[model samples]
Target: MVNIVENIRKQIDDAVRNSVSKAVEAGELPEFEIEEVTVEIPKEKSHGDFSTNIAMQTARMAKKAPRQIAEIIVKNMDLEGTYIEKVEIAGPGFINFYLNNNWLYDSLKDIQRLREEYGRIDVGGGQKVMVEFVSANPTGPLHMGNARGGALGDCIASVLERAGYDVTREFYVNDAGNQIEKFGISLEARYLQLLKGEDAVEFPEDGYHGEDIIEHMKNYIEEHGDKLLDVDSSERRKALVEYALPKNVERIKKALEEYGVTFDVWFSEQSLYDSGEIEETLEYLKEKGYTREEDGALWFKATLFGAEKDEVIVRNNGVPTYFLADIAYHRNKFLKRNYDRVINLWGADHHGHVFRMKCGVEAFGIDPDKLDIVIFQLVRLYRNGEIARMSKRTGKSISLTDLLEEVGRDAARFFFNTKASGNHLDFDLDLAVKQSNENPVYYVQYAHARICSMLKVLESEGIKVPDVDEVNVSLLDKEEEIELLKKLAQYPEEIRLTAETLEPSRLTRYVYDVAAAFHSFYNACRVKGEEEEIMNARLILVDSTKIVIRNVLELLSINAPDKM
Candidate 1:
């Protein structure tokens, strides 16, 4: 059974093609024509679930008035045995298809069998994709802000994976940079104070001022006392700086895993320099003519290709800017691996950098479309209506670990899951922690638990559940029953749209929609066995609803508890 959207799109496409053929035969249109089939969801439910502008688009070439052409197209639409209950022409000749109930009822059973495979499509086909996100500088624990990017990247990857894209999740670690240097200097200050028993710790200028830095340094001193203290102050400081990069990275890694993120690749910035790839990429760019030099330093003439100004690749001091390493990282993701698509989930603070990066990629002659960037806006977490002003450098920022504990993983994921990725999100702890229906997480999970409770009770009474293929779905077509079935039927379209837009909120929202429908059905309708056949039919609907609920919850990495 094909999805309703795809099924209808095919028939509409065929109809439009036939309309064009008729016009061409009448010598009113060209022998061959080009047009896009527009199968869009209509804004007004009275119109139809989907509206197509195919007739309007073909009118120009066909030399027919748009409305006149629309009728010709609709007449050719082969709606036999298909779900279409009616097709209407409106708004300068758009074709809208309204589906019937049997199609909706049958969809519920198909979705149940598909479960994990539900809402999935081959929009990405077998194309290889790499999604790099939450790649914060590995110099501290992940802040609540950075954690937002992690959740988004991980969730988007999940969406793409479900859409049949061969997607790889990656984290780019900036381990060999200025931030790491500052991290070490701050830790060394505390280390010296503890080891030499100085009056107090004096943090270096431009160094970390976090309370965690002092604690991390204190731990280092207690374990390995004065090991580098024999060297000059500056030399020992450099040594501490070198050691603390790995130290901070290890801490960041533990926190990310604790926050429920698993990366298939954790790419290091230093590795680019070490493996000669950074130099290699620079030389490649130079050869390709996107470079320049001034004031005894090497620069890239990015402005020649529309950048605000040319950018420095290497300083007079011979150190490459962070920009150089990033160019190399993106090159490896695109040129070396030949991924069908490369997506970077970046924080909005770096929004200004989009042009220069895209310029550099296109300068290489690769398709610019292959590289997509999704920017995550800032997050403000409110506890009792007070704003949380937390930062990694100040140690005042809320850690992802603390968040998981306070709100629990299910709540945090659901809170993050509900909002659009690009919009600034407000995490209201008061609302999220509520145990009753006020909490969206509790509501969805509660629906799952109630169905499980009903199932367990039925099992205890020795009632048998229907197999998906054996489901007498036509028997489940009561008004409330078919309404729930319609929601289940929407899974494929939901997954397809989410994958197409690279937005997981659509999928997340659909989960809540289905849950609400189930809850309403639960309150209004009963499913018990004084009458076995009807009871079995209702059981199939509830069980299928449960499968759809668990499927979406898994995508968000939120659990669907069987019991409240």
Candidate 2:
């Protein structure tokens, strides 16, 4: 809740506005109304700590050159009771403010006082949000795509929660649809081939060909041999589906949980059908004149909602398409569950479905802007400096379980989130498992561990981290110490930005920066061997750094080890 950087930025903004007001009152400048003030961190260190373009923004209104206006504002500025150490006019009309180390000193106190809650901010205002991701089909194991989506979605949900949203992490179970039907066919054919003979039945070309399908049938035969051989094929397929679907769903659940993601809702796609919501949605669309019959099939006029053409909601055989089911599912999310916002994490293959789904939600009287779809690109796993297409265990596309087994939960999640969701990811298995600083997760975790080890050593020597009031934090004015404090102060702002952008990759980069700063501070300033007062001040700084690193790692669901 305590954002030191935001607090300082607001202070700077107010001081700048007041200076302009004072200038206007003194008749040194024309009287003009100021609507807003903008303040931001300077990209270069020489440009000062914070910069604003108020002079440029008000030039046309003030009827004066921007540089003249900037000089007048600086002359009238009062630096007392503020962190502004010096003000400079740079590059045409930009006003930059250099700060004393007060903000950095205050940040250490805030971190110590807030502890684990240091980075939390109330940007969401308790609005209800549902993040649905990794809704893989129940017929097969989760692949590399699911791995990336799981990490990104789960971390995003965590970021939202930290930003004070009432967030629900959900996994939509695609347990019913064309894929389930194909699953039944695959299981039935595999069952017959194992019992009757391979030549007795032909596997459908569109059926699933994963080894898990064959394993499911073999397990079923081992438990109950040929019990469905005499039954009708329809009944046999239903029995097989009933026996295998739950296991597959359960496997998916276990894999996700192992990958450090637990869904609050495992919403089943079949629930919409069984609850009659699908039928009701179709009827509602028909009543609204959005539907028509074409070639004996019921079609929804998708072009009205910006689609390329009309779409079939129900086929001529009376079976509903997945599109209809999807509409009903979103209707349930918005109208029934009453979430203020819903986010879906999907693979890039679903890019074309994004706008249509938004259109569908709009037809239900829901604001389409509330529906956010994050389409992440594919991930290609690499091992031994080569693309790894097959898992050593399954000899198939590498599963999430296989990825977890190969590197680890921390490395996998960290590496998957190292890039923006829009960029294609080449997961380096070799780099992920490395123990050196080349591995980012290792580097960050080592920073935390190094601090912990240092603290333990000092604790044995009867030198504990002192309270904020116990030491002079002004002693932490060294270059490396100031840079580390600046990084620590940016945590709350980082959380706010991550929530706004719905990007967990920001935190990954941020924590690495914090680690880098800590490493720099560790080498430049000696915490253990310094003078008593300086050592305690550095101890407090180091302790605060540990808290921030752990906080970010916890948000990403990665562990911070006490030893590396």
TM-score of each: 0.93, 0.95
Give the per-residue lDDT digits (tens) of candidate 1, residues 239-293.
7666666777778778778767788988878789899998898888889787888
Candidate 1, position 252, lDDT:
75
Model 2 alpha-carbon drift over 4 Å, by segment: 19-36, 58-65, 72-80, 306-309
Q: Which tens-of-lDDT digit does each residue in 227-337 have in candidate 2?
A: 999999889999999999999999999999999999999999999989999999999999998899988999988888888988888999999999999999999999999
- The collision pairs in model 1 are 390-397, 391-397
Best by lDDT: 2
For model 1, where is the 10-residue window of minimal lDDT?
388-397
TM-score of 1: 0.93
Q: List the residue pairs that clash in candidate 2.
A: none
**How far in Å is the alpha carbon of 268 misplaced in model 1?**
1.1
